[model samples]
Target: MRHLTLLGGLVLGLAVAGGAQPMTAAPATTPLSAIAALRDPAGQVIGTATFRQMGQGVQVSVEARGLPPGGHGMHVHEYGRCTPGVDPATNTVVPFGGAGGHFDPGMSRNHDDPQAPNKYGHGGDLPMLNVGADGVGRATFTSDKVSLTGMNGVLNRSLVIHANPDDYKSDPSGMSGARLRCGIISRNGLTTRDYPLPGAQDFPEGVAYDARKGVIYTGSAVNGTIYAVDAASGAVSKFQEGGALGRRAALGLKVDPQGRLWIAGGAQGTVSILSPDGVTLKVLQTPDSPNPYINDLTLAPDGNVYVTDSTRPVIFRVDPDLTLTRWLDLGDTPVKYGPGINLNGIAATPDGRYLLAIQLNTGELWRIDLRSKAVQRVMGGLERGDGLLLDGRTLYVSRNAMQVVSKVSLSADYGSGQVVAEEPLRGLRFPATLAAVGGDLVVTQSQLDKLQGGTPETPFRLTRFRKF
Candidate 1:
């Protein structure tokens, strides 16, 4: 069978039949855990193993069937490949020889006991795996020498099962015989910390960060209550009362350079601008007769605010002087608005000459030229895209229904892009938006999918994904 290797961080599987997938530098991971599926020479998956972080050590569990009924050796190999190759020492072909030798990040070159320290033994050394009469073997243990992340991490490594038992004292491989099965290790998810909100059913939707005061701002989808969280302590406080100034629901939020909050009034067809002191400075609205659902907004470099209406095929713009106007209408262009939720998230290019928005139903990205009033569909699919954040030429799309964050690298003109990575971050439950604060990604767990006559998780929280 064909084999595909898994790389840690931003890089995932290798090239498949169609074409090569885009890859980039690895992202920072902490206390990472992994799992592997053991495959025999015939490409048949026979077993599995799991690795987890527990305190300062790593816990390992392995279970396999259809093996010899005796003691066998198991080790974390140096490489992540499971294909056959020529053995350097034997000058002959070896089963699963591509995995290389035992993992020895410290370069100790010793295959001592697992209980020994890293300086004295290889980090991959473990106790012998004993098989029963039913050809089933299982082992569970903890090791302090190896880690799941960092320099000594094994996320992109390989696990191998040897034919003979380990002697615990022999050099190189403890007199273990030929390798029988090998599996490539892959990461499960990034570690996360939760910052809970106050109400049991707040259903927080949007997130924004104020660097000056080191605070995070989020709003409630249920009643438009805006809450501020201290970046250093995760302390939650009310920033604005719910449903103030005829605003029924709050969705997307952005903190301007002047520290004023630009709030989107969902389904109210209005946009409210509030000062840092929680006082409403101004409110803008669209025509109430046709009805509109203002879902998200973005701040441009020229100090203009662009908003997206989910129900209507139109975009509204608010000038720096607080003057609101109908910026662009998709009905007048080639872009078609589907039946369900249309445009959800809005973001502008750094040059302020173009704006990019996502259509949830069609999963299409549209680019609008501010200078020419021209609109064109960007080349990429981001279905279920809820929030959009642009950092230089890279765009981050939060897919709420898929429970994944897609990293897209845009071209120079912002007309085309490709998904470089899609990470399913841990502790995210129906994530609605994303905010970069102090090198960490703050994501809101809106839980909106379960809001149909069902009880939401108590004390809904925002998660901090530690990504550098």
Candidate 2:
């Protein structure tokens, strides 16, 4: 926050956080501090912010231009997403609305100074900025309310510059004016990545997240061993050995609403139904076939479990009681695979009327009518669509080979789709699957390309992106 005087002179300069003199130089071994670029809804990069560790606290330098001439409130927002200033229909000040409110870890929800370090103000609240007549401003200050490391760290959070000045005592953020720009903070220009199952030859082909349990589940595609990952800590532990887990490879996983862990046994031609405690209660084997590969499974609101068979041109169905049967042989589309793998990812519509499945080898998205058991190709050429997830009308397809997540919008008829956007996740080694926890999406970096060449010391990890 700026230290102001009666003369209206902007009085804040870059200083060491703990009141000590600013360091003349960063150590050779010490890496550079964090940085972020604030962009408005129109995708204009209007401001830049940096975080540097100083004597007592983290020092933050903020520089922006083209802002209102005078004081404007600045703070970190809760969400990383930066949305437009107005709802097209409402025409209200929704600027950076997707970034949510101030970063209030606690529900205090008040707007106060970060220097106070009290429960009264939000931790995100910072000093107001004073733009000159030129509409440009640069100020640096330290905050005791934030840290460069630890759980309360600012990484991945959104930095926002507001339109109006902060009164310093308003109930919520000094009733700060609409957000003008926002940028997600990060270190070394890196994305939010967790792990690649982190070990030599560890390929996590599938990931299943249980929001209720606060746990994520995945397994080794090579040995069919199941492991549990701590969502908060990134800790990995062996949950179930391969002895009881059916099949040669554990490919896909889903945590059903009933708390059961449904696993697909790739190449084993079966699905394993396990208790929440990791006990294999039953194994539902697909009908006898030359080569049956149950690749993935998703639970439908209609109380049925749907499985995708990559080798067979069929969608397998498993009842709540563990009874397995051929729900539909989607013979409408021929099998287009290289190594006996085709249909890989499956998702059920919220209305429970249609099933959307994507073929791995061909990148074809097919919509299957649940009632008639008929299949229709909605679109094709997704380029290695491995995991398919539906949230409302948006379908997120993870193209493993292309190393990108394509977000498609489904038409009202559910028979067609258009690529709305693509999240180019270049950091992903081999993202095989995706799961949504809350509004955030987590991707499993199976690193199959590395693992395929045989065991190496590099471990695989998960990459996460927050939407809200």
After superposition on all CA atoms, what RMSD does each candidate show versus the true structure? 16.4, 19.9
Per-residue C-alpha lDDT of model 1 across residues 1-468, encoded as one tens digit per residue: 111111223332111111223233244343446889999999899999988766556788999888999999888887778989767668788889878788875567788887777677788887778999999999998877766543345665788999999987787888888898888876663345677999876999999999999999999998999999987788899999897888778899999999999899888888999999889998898876576899999999888899999998888989888898888878989679878888898898989899988888887888899889799888646777888888888887777765556778899999898777755544245678889875567878797876753335557888776433
TM-score of 1: 0.64
Query: Runs in model 2 with CA error above 4 Å?
Result: 1-190, 196-199, 245-247, 332-340, 454-457
Where does candidate 1 stray beyond 4 Å? Answer: 1-189
> Clash totals for all models, in order?
0, 13
Model 2 lDDT, residue 301, Cα: 90
Candidate with top TM-score is 1
TM-score of each: 0.64, 0.59
| Local error of candidate 1 at residue 148 (angstroms) | 17
The digit string of per-residue lDDT tens for model 2 on 1-468 reads: 222111111111111221233323222234226777988668899889998645335688988988879988899876556775443334576867766667754346577776655366677888888899998989898776764432234655689888888887886668667778788876542335464464455578888998888888887788888888877777778778765744557888999887888888988888988889888888888888888777899999989999998888788888867789887756644444466468899999999999998887777898888898767889976767898888888888877745556678899878998775545332344568888866567887675754544222244667666531
lDDT of 1: 0.78
The per-residue C-alpha lDDT of model 2 at residue 136 equals 91
lDDT of 2: 0.72
